[model samples]
Target: MDDVSSDKHPDRGGTRRILLAGPRSFCAGVERAIEIVERALQAHGAPVYVRKQIVHNISVVEDLAARGAVFVEELDEVPDGATVVFSAHGVSPAVREEAARRGLDVLDGTCPLVSKVHAKARRFADRGDTVVFVGHAGHEEVEGTLGEAPESMVLVETAEDVRRLTPEDAERVSYLTQTTLAVDETTEVLGALRERFPLLHEPPSEDICYATTNRQLALDAVVAESDLVLVVGSANSSNSVRLVELSQRQGTPAKLIDRAAEIRTEWLEGVRTVGLTAGASAPPALVDEVVAALGELGPVEVEERRITDETMHFELPSALRGTAGSRTSGGQS
Candidate 1:
C-alpha cells in the first residue's frame, strides 16, 4: 500500500526522543497549491483530473486522490471536457496547447515564481539570446522549463555540464533555474556558466524558491551537531531529495522517508544526536508525528534553529484568482 499521510496514532514508546528541524516542510507555493486543489474539489465536485501530483508528496497526492482528485501524466490521458488542474510544477506552452486542444476546463496551479522563469525563457528566446536552464535532468519542473525553449536553451545539471555547452553567441546567452534546486549547487552552476559565457544575463529574480533556500539553511545549522539526519519527505520530492543530499554532502548520514515506518533501527545506531528536516512539499504535521514517534525511541531534546524568515507568495491564475487571502506566500493551511 502507498504510504499516505500519517494520522493520529497511539504514542509508541521508543527512546522518546524527537529533534525537530526548524524551517522544515511546506513553503508558500506548496501550501497554496494544496489549498487550490482542495478548494477546487470543494467548489467543483469530483472528476478533477490533475495533470501530475499537485506537489511531489505521495501522501498528499493520495490524500487528494481519496478526496476525488485524479492524477494523470498528460492532458491526453484526461477525458474530453473534463475539469483538469495543472500541478504547482509548471508545464510548457505545448502542454497548455494540448490541454486546450482537448477542450479540458483547465485550472492552472503553477507557482508564480515558476511562471516567472517561463516568462524569462520566452523573452530570451524572443530576443535571440541562447537561454541555459540550470537544473537536474528528468525533474518535472526542469522538463517544464525545458519545454519553454528546447532548441534554444540547454539544460545544465551542474557547473561541469555548463562548460560543455557551446552556444553560438556567448555574448548573448542568458539563464533560468528550476525553482526547487539547492541554493549552493545552483550558485556553483551559475559560477561555471559565468566563467564560460563571460556575459550571460540571468533572470531578474532568482528561480530557486524562497522556502527551499530557507529550509536548506536551517538544515546546515541543525545538522552540524547531529549524528544522524532524518529528512521526512517522499522519495520523489526534489527539494526533499536535495536535503538528504545536502546532509550527505556535508559528510553527515541522512535518511529520507515518507513517514516513520521507513525509519530503521540502524539509522540511529551510535546516533546520540539526530537531526530532522523535511522537503518543501512535505507537511509540518507529518514532521511533528515523526518527532513524536522518535520520542518513543529514547530521551530526545528538540531544538528550533532560527534561520532567515520567508515572505514569498504566488498568485493563482487569473481564472482561479479571487479576492482571496494570499495563500501563495509562505501561507500555511
Candidate 2:
C-alpha cells in the first residue's frame, strides 16, 4: 500500500482516509467498444444508430449520444441500410440475422471474451452436451449467450437453480458463466453443480473475465480496511453490483453509485475510512470525481491497494482498423 495525501482541509477537524482499489474502471473490452463507436462516428458522421448502449455506463452512453450516436432497443427502430454497432455485451445470432435481412451495415463491438463464451456454447451444443450457463436471467450478455443454443442451454442464477435443473442427458453436462460475476458466489454455485453432477465438464479456461476477477480481488482487500465501500458504476452493471454485495457479505457497508452526485451524505456520516472502486464499464473520471467529493467533506488521505497489474488489450474490429483515433485519457487498467 502506498499512501498519497491530498492537501489538508482547513475547515474540517479530522482527516478521512480513502483506500482506492487498483485495476478499477474501464477494462480493455470497454475501451475497445467505446473506441469502435468513436471511430464509427468519425468515419460515418452523426446519426450512427447503435443497437444498444455500447457499454452499460451512463456516462459513456451519454457521451456517445452527445456525439450523435442514436441508441435503439432493437433493429426495428433503425432505418433500413443505416450502419449499426452492437453493444459490448454480445448480441444473439437472431439479431445478426435481423440486421442482415434489413441490409443494415453492421459493426460488431462484442467483447472478445464474451464471443469466446458464445463459441463454447455452440461447441457444447454440437457435441450433444447440455450447457448449464451460470448467469443472471435478464442480463444482455446472458440473453445473448442463451440465444446461441437456447434449446440446449439452461440458465441458473443460483445453486438452488442448479438443484432444479434436470438435463435430458445428466451425464453429458457442461458449464459456462457470465464474464462479470462475483468470484466467491460463483464458486459456491459451481460447488453445488459439482455435487449434483460429479462428471460436470468445465470450460477449458475460466469464463469470468480477468478484469472482473481483478476488481473483485482488489476490492476484497480494500473492503477489509474500509468503514464504507463506494463502488462507481451504473445499477445495470453486474460486476459493479457484485462489488457492493461482496462488501456487505464481508460484514462491511457498501453502496453502488453511478457518479459522485449520487453519493448520499448520510453514507459518510461516521465513515472514517472509505473504499473506492469503479466497474469495468465505468469511466475512470468518475472515480476521480468521487475522491474529490470525499475531500470536500474533510481532509482525505488516499492509499492505493494494488493486488495485480492488468495489461490486457483487445484490438478494434478489422473494419475499424487503422482508423482509430487517440486513446481515451484515463488508462484502461
Candidate 3:
C-alpha cells in the first residue's frame, strides 16, 4: 500500500496538485454502507462476513480485508451467527430471510435507487404485466431486481435480448434496469423494448440515477480531448469497469488502476493529455495519488470535465432508528 504513498510524486519539495474529478468519491448510499462495515469491524472486530463486494471496488475490499472483514458469496460460506453485510447492489427477500434465519447480524447496504427498482419490478409483476428487466444477466443488481418478481421478470442483456424475448403478456409488459448500467446500452435495450412491445409501460422514475449518467457523459467529453484516460477504480467494480469501456468506446485508450502503484510508466510514454476519473466505489485519495505519480513523470496540467453537478443524498436506514451516525470517507455509488 506504501507504493501509493504521496512520496511517489518525486518532487524535491512537496505534493503536486491536479484538477480533481468533480462528483467523484462516495455517494450517500456508499457512505452509509461503508460506515456500516467500519462500525461493524470496530464494534464487533475480526471476520465480519460481507456477502459480496460491499460496493464492488477491489481496493475497498482489500482495505476492509486487512481490517478483518471476510467477504463471502453465499450465506452458507459464513458460520452461523456471524455478522454480515448484504452489499450495495441489494439482495432478494429470500436472502434477507436466510440471513435472519441463520441469526446473522445483518447490515444491508442496498442502494436506495436499486431498492426502488426492486419495488417497481415487484409491483409491475403483481399487475400481471410480463416484466422485462433490462440489464446484464447474472449481475448482482439484475439478480436483485429479478428477485423482486423472479416468477415474472425476464432478463435481457442487449437489444437482441429484448427482440428475442416473447413475453407471455406483451400488451401489459413493463421494464426496469440495473442502476450502474451504461446509458447507451440501456438506451439500446429500451429501443428494442419499444419496437417489440409498442405499448410497453415505462417506470415512473428512470432506474438509472443521475450520477451514473453524468459520470459517463463527463468521460465522453474528456476522452476526445485527452491522449489517454486513467480510470481510478478496481476491475471488480462494475462502474469502474464501465468507465474504462466508455473511454475505449469513445476511441480513447484507457486503463483501470486500483492505486497509483498499478500505473505502468510505459502507458504514459508519448502521452501528454491524461484524463483521470474514478468509479463509484473508488476513493478520491487514490485519484490524487495517480495525479501525483503523473507529476513525477512530467509537468502535469490537470483539468476537470464535468457534465453536471451532483447534490443528491439518501438517508440512513431507520433500522438503526436514527440513533446512530452513518458516514464513510470516499468512493462511488
Candidate 4:
C-alpha cells in the first residue's frame, strides 16, 4: 500500500488533491469469499478449480490464478470429483445439485448476504407469494436468486417495468432486490410497485447491502468537492459500475478503470481535486496503485473523507473455519 501521508500539494491550475473515500475497497463479504478460495487452495493444494471469478475484480482473479486457481465458465469444464469453489455471488439450487451429481468436492464462497436473498426468495415462493425482484437482468446474483423461485419471481429493471408486471396473484405479492443496485433507482421502482399494489410486501430488511449504500453515500460527498472521480474496478462489477454512474448523474465526470493504466491523461488535463474510490469487490492495493500513478502527473495531495466506519465481518464458512486462514486479513488471505 502507498504510504504517502494525507497532506496538501500544489499543482499548476490549483491544489492537486485526491479525496479518498473510506469504506471504498473490499467489504466483509468480499473478504470472506476470497479467503475461502485461498484456504481451499492451501488445504487441497494447487490447480483448484473455481466455477467463476472469486469476485468481480480482475486483479483479484489474476492473483489467485497465479497461485493455481483455475477459473472456468461452467462446472462441466471442471474434472469430475475435483474440488470446486463458487464465486462470491451465490449460485442456484440447480448448480448445487449439478456439483453434487458430478461428485465434486464443493466449497461455496458465496457471500452470506447473497445466500440470505436466496433463502428469502425460496420462502416467499413456498408460501405462494409472487416475488418482484429488482436488479440487472443477467447479473450472476440475479441469476442465482431467480433460480430460487423461477416460477414465482418477476424481474423488473426500471420503474416502467414495474408498471408492466402482472403478477399471478396481485394480492399476494412481495419484493426483493439485488444487493448491489443503486439505492435511488431501486427506490423509484419500489415506489412504482407500491402505487400499483398498496399492500406490497418488502424484505424483512432493506434488500440492498449496507456496503453498497455506504459507498454511494460516500461518493455523494466525494463528488461534491471533486472535479473528476476515478472509480477503481472492473466493467462486470455491478456495484462498481453503479459508482461511476452515480458520479456521472451527480454531474461530476467519472471513469471506471480496472487499474491505474486505464486512467487517461486527457481526463486529468485541467482537473484539480480528484475523487478516488473502489468497488466493494476491489482491493485497496488497486487504489494505492492509482494514487501512485496520479503522483507522477504532478504533486498530488490526499485527504480521506470517511462516511462511516465499517466493523462488519463475515466469518469463513463453518466447513472451513478453524483452519489455516482463521485470522487472515483480506489482503494476506
TM-score of each: 0.89, 0.94, 0.88, 0.94
Sort the predicted structures by TM-score, highest score first. Answer: 2, 4, 1, 3
Which number leads on lDDT? 2
Candidate 2, residues 297-326: lDDT per residue as tens digits?
Answer: 878988899998889999898888978486
Comparing 3 and 4 by lDDT, which wins?
A: 4
TM-score of model number 1: 0.89
List all candidate RMSDs to the true structure.
6.6, 4.0, 6.0, 4.3
**Residue-wise C-alpha lDDT for candidate 1, range 250-289, written one tens digit per residue:** 8778999998778888777656667888898887777777
Q: 139, model 3: CA deviation in Å?
A: 1.6
lDDT of 2: 0.90
For model 2, which pairs clash?
A: none
- Model 3 alpha-carbon miss at residue 94, Å: 1.4
Q: Where is model 1 more than 4 Å wrong at Cα?
A: 1-18, 318-333
In order, the Cα lDDT scores of the candidates are 0.80, 0.90, 0.77, 0.88
In candidate 3, what are the lDDT values of residues 1-333, reduced to their tens digit?
112233433332332324344566556667667777877776677888898888877777888888899999999999998888888899998899888898988878888888888888888888899988877767888787787778898888888777788877779998888887888877888998898899989999888776677678777766765557888887766777888898888777889888899989888664556778888778777887887788887666666766677778776555543444434454222
Tell me the deviation in Å of residue 25 in model 1. Answer: 0.6
